[model samples]
Target: MKLLQRYILGELIRVFGLLVVVLTIMLVFVGLFREATERGLGPVQILQIMPFVVPSMLPFTIPATLLLSVCVVYGRISADLEVIAAKAAGISAMRMLAPAFLFGTVLAVASFGLTNYAIPWAVANIERIVTQAVEDIFIDMLRTQHLVSEPSRGYSITVHDVQNRTLIDATFRFRTHDHHQITVRAEAARIHFDLERQQIELKLRNATYSNPGADSFGDWDGTVLHLPLPPQIHATKARHLTVADLTEKTKEAVLQDEIGQIQQANEAAMLMLTGDFHQFGGKEYSQLKGANAEAVRNQRRFKTEIHSRVAMAFSCLFFTLVGGPFSMLQARRQFITSFIMCFLPILLIYYPVMFLMVNLCKSGTLDPTWSMWVPNGILLIAGAMTLRKVMQH
Candidate 1:
């Protein structure tokens, strides 16, 4: 029976590792293939960028592998009457799988760390690389003297002829957001693309800028002003930024229970009594007392994020205990059924808790801590019930 346990754990780990590799190749190729058409970078460039993209995906892939590995390996054992044989020999089915569940716990712990730390860093860099690639492509196009688009800010011109290190004929189109009409037509009497400063200088024989937001355009047909380009025009997109970067940038919006706040208040006010909002600290008191809605909401959101992380880590232990008695039923041994049963229950636990927590924060009914433990609590109760039944049998 001990050997059987070893055998099962080995087989499952092998399967899990193989799946991770296969999934990586498939996903990376798909990502590259899709992006290739629009970016038009050469193969060498794609290869260079693949390393940065792959690591971030592992956190998502690993959890899925853990779930399926337990299911398939345990399910098959039950199908073969192996559970009955083990039981007859005084080996409890649940007892036999103590090892596999432990592995799951380890994977979950690692995943939590990755989610918080490693993935965030990779995500931050992903954008920078992609941005550099796009800039390279645009620069390459400029060499052919094509009319390259400058990210809706204006048109771009490539210089092929120059006198005294000054550009000969450089003019980019400038337009309002509608883009239907060209707002500026300037042939640079002279131009210099400054690499050091990362900007293009257009010494326009004539230039014009249409101020669209003001519904006005100042008179100018022949002048070039050095305009500062958007630094991130060559920037990598959102995916490249790490979680910390995201947290730093958008934490303000996320906090404040902004999205569902109005809805929650409306629902609660219908039954909870409207004036209670004033007693807790009216909107006016919030200002004088420095107790604003945004701060409260932000605190709730942060707490929610913390609890959510803890609950996910706790899942590793929950899943392991589950695999134990499930093995006893011999029901857990079927590859197909076991995988489905194990994975589905987990998803059910995870998503609902997430959903409820978000709502609780919005509804003002749950603090972050209580909302997070809901999912773990449900899973623990379910596992306990199953374990009790299996041990009795």
Candidate 2:
């Protein structure tokens, strides 16, 4: 039994490794090309960022890769009559499948770790690195070019030229937060980087700034313009937060919601006691407006995200449960055919269903606790039926 387990486990591991490498490389190049074109990233920059990018891709690839590996390895083994020999020697099919089950359990744990910790960390770092690279390019352009236009940043600047540390015929068009346009034309400007404060200060000589809609413009001599660059490492997106972080955030949200409910109830009681029934409307309780509504929505998303992570992690086990029995039934078929048979449905049915569930979960149409596990539940039932057939045969 030990030897049989070792043999099966070794084969699965070897096949899994090969599949992971191939899939990871394919995904890496896809990402590399996309990022290179989008960010105008040089080969050196892409190479620098590649390591960080792979971790994010691995979680997506691992479960599918595991499914394929299980199919190929187990299908080939069963095709060669290895399972028949084991059964002839008084071994049950479950005993032969023990290693596969163990492998799936380990991967399930690993997937959880990857989803909760590694992917979030990688994504946050990628954002930080990309933002810093853009900032560096902006700084370089400011130092060398007479004119610089960054469409993404919504800024256009033109100068007669730069000599020593001074600019001439400098005009800058900046978009304000309120969607108003601010155009500043200066006779001369001095560009200074405040290293201590991490700010860029443009000291304008004989400048005027005007709103496009306004008839009149304000003029100043030797006006100092200071703009602070974003810090190198911005806060990670709430969705990218770890499970522990999300748990605390979820608790706070729940508390706030409970408090709001209590307050609303108290207010309703007061209104009723004071005979102000007109003040409360049917729509009032159902309608969550402003920050309160936003907070509730965000809490739902956070809860959903956390549940989805856990659900995704366990997909390793679910896929294995489904794949092992499936491969055994198709044991006599060609390995490639068996692989395709196992892989296609996962791509077609499982992924689409999983995506739909996730969207529903995020939109608050479905509860995450139940909705996230629907695909797994279906797979589990299917796997059980297949396992029964395999054992009987």
Instruction: State which candidate has the highest TM-score.
Output: 2
* Per-residue C-alpha lDDT of model 1 across residues 255-329, encoded as one tens digit per residue: 444544654555446535754654445443344234336555555555555556656655666766665456445
lDDT winner: 2
Q: Model 1 misses residue 254 by how many Å? A: 11
Q: Rate the local accuracy (lDDT) of all candidates.
A: 0.60, 0.80
Candidate 2 lDDT tens digits, 235-340: 4566577999998988888787777777677768887999989867655544433335666877887898898888888998989888898898889547678778
**In model 1, which regions exceed 4 Å deviation?**
1-8, 30-45, 85-94, 150-310, 330-333, 345-349, 352-366
